[model samples]
Target: MKLKELEQLKNEGVDHISSIERRRFLKLGFLVTGVYLGGKALSLAPLTEAQAAEVVPPKGKYSYSPHYSMVIRERLCINCELCVEACNGTNDVPSYGYRTDILERRRAIVDDKYETIFMPVLCNHCNRPPCVRVCPTTATWKDETTGIVKMNPGRCIGCKTCMTACPYNARYFKEEGRFVDKCNFCYDTLLSKGAKETACVTACPADVRVFGDLADTNSRVYELLHTPETLVWVLRPKTGALPNVYYTNA
Candidate 1:
């Protein structure tokens, strides 16, 4: 309240603030200093992460016809790796690489307790796929009808540009095929043959992987994401990839 105390406080300039820095502030409530440069500037209340990120697209705005997607029931995964096995068998994935993987994390729970969490990871099949954008060869692309990110090995040229651009680290170079490969939701082996689910979905013993057409109102994926009070999230949302893969515990 004193004049001297107010004078000692320094102003934090708005210049050079990165998007990531702004996102951090968006996640919590904070007062922001405002500047007016001949135009109106509004200072609004802080937004929660979900509101700020707009993680889920609005209804009727789906880009693909079928809007193929997968939902991972994160808590249900037990690291059995049956899904991995099935993917390898179905896709003929080499030993040194994987189209899907399971990751483990330990979280602190009630007093002095830790719980192990297993996460199933694969290509997210982003609506704004970085891989597709960076590929000079047009080897990898998102299927317009199904929304699956697919690869044409013949045109790949083994450049690995797509591999670097992928935020999820989902693609890997196949020594035998001499090209980059990633999960395509089993579009080639199963889905293209009129299969309802991907190999991983069928092999998951814990029912962790749920695959369906998100655009269909009657589909389970749409129901899971729209259910009241359920928290649905995607990995690397900060990347602005708009991934189709979602995760939920409910």
Candidate 2:
């Protein structure tokens, strides 16, 4: 039946699901489950023709040398806020602002039993950054060497265009700096000083944050991405940003 017919039935207080409706629902459920499971299995297999086509990078794209990325082992985060404190201190972030923060998600499992997860979020530093595209003054751009999204404070006009364009809500206006500021994976603060990891990564007691070069196959981030029977995902993947930050279970 058409959607209008279904609405009409609902308007007439017809709440019962007929046998035909039940069969249709079951068929759809099976189809969805099969497709999901199939994709999971395919991700673990060696790159075939179809898989290679999907995974391979197109020429002239924003592929970087080090391809700096971070992986959040979400299941291990305990909302301690030590990482946040480390980030604020390292970057001189104000009390009103943050380069990283924690979010809470709660779900009811069964019989009033609930599970809560603390999710830590930061700048994704996308390969195809919407913030970079929207910047009129070219104040923000992705670093060619590290693939980290960087900001030039002097060039910013405080127009807030980049702030609006960012899908992750990662950018914030700094009153003292008189410019938009965001996470650069602590590149200028620590990485340039020869540190191997970001402040947040080093401060996490639970080892929840893994920061490294994604391009290097020997790196932890690369191995985590390649691990079989593991689920890896990026936030707002539908935005087509190709974020460098990834999330997965411990």
Q: Which candidate is the best by TM-score?
A: 1
Worst 10 residues of 2 by lDDT: 47-56
lDDT of 1: 0.87
lDDT of each residue in 120-238, candidate 2, tens digit only: 99999877788987888889987868888999999999999998989999999999999999999999999999999999999999999999987788889888877878888888777
lDDT of 1 by residue, 1-250 (tens): 9755644556467647654566578654333333342123221111122122478777877878799999999999999999999999999999999999999999999999999999899999988788987888889988879889999999999879999999999999998878999999999899889999999999999999999998888999999999999999999998977899999998
Off by over 4 Å in 2: 1-62
What is the alpha-carbon RMSD of candidate 2 to the true structure?
14.8
Off-target runs (Cα >4 Å) in candidate 1 are: 1-53
**Candidate 1: pairs in clash:** none
- lDDT values, one for every candidate: 0.87, 0.84
